[model samples]
Target: MDLIADILLAAGALGAGIYCLVLGRRLNRFNDLEKGVGGAVAVLSAQVDDLTKTLSSAQNTAAGSAQTLTDLTQRAEEMSRKLEFQMASLHDIPDTPAREATATPAAPVSAQTTSEPMFVRHRAAEAHQ
Candidate 1:
């Protein structure tokens, strides 16, 4: 009976040793820096770093564009205000050049004749003679 117990204990020890060896090998493979979970993690870490830099650069570009847009908006508003003022001033003028040239019935005919161009004045003098 003692000999049988000793044989059983030896067999269990051998089996345990074999299982431990296989587990150790699998653990080594899982932690390998190349072609394993460790390698995948390293690749992911590098990608995250690259994405972080790209995001920062994009944010900077967007901020610059926003500032430019604000400046342009202010300039456009100023120009619109100036145009409105100019339009109002044009409205204040009493008469256009065309209306002034035609002359109203209220003015003396002689005033219209005197205001004529030099060529017209000479032509009138010749006609009178």
Candidate 2:
């Protein structure tokens, strides 16, 4: 009976030792995993910071572009108004002299009939024809 008890006790001790070894190894692995995760978090934080900076720069650029576009639009509108004003002013000019000039007639052919030479008479006759 004593020999059997000693053997049982030794077997239990061996099992407990094995369990502790495995548990310690597992604990070490968990610690290593924790360190790896911490490193990854740091890297991610740096990446986020970089992304934030890039976003800010992009926003600033967009604001500047919007301002430039606004200025260009205002200039275009001003130019359009000036063109409209010039066109309106042109419509106010009088056409009376133009109409009178177009209405006036040449001298009568009978008045210059004798003084005109042969070529002029020929042209006049051609025009009359």
| Cα lDDT computed for each candidate against the true fold | 0.88, 0.84
Error of 1 at 127 (Å): 34
> What is the per-residue lDDT of model 2 for residues 44-122, given as tens digits with 9 covering 90 to 100?
8899999999999999999999999999999999999999999999898755577675788655758757775655445
lDDT of 1 by residue, 1-129 (tens): 999999999999999999999999998898788978988899999999999999999999999999999999999999999999999999976564866657744467587578657444467778988
Relative to the true structure, candidate 2 reaches a TM of 0.48
User: Which 10 residues in a row give candidate 2 its minimum summed lDDT?
Assistant: 30-39
Against the true structure, whose TM-score is highest? Answer: 1
Model 2, residue pairs in steric clash? none
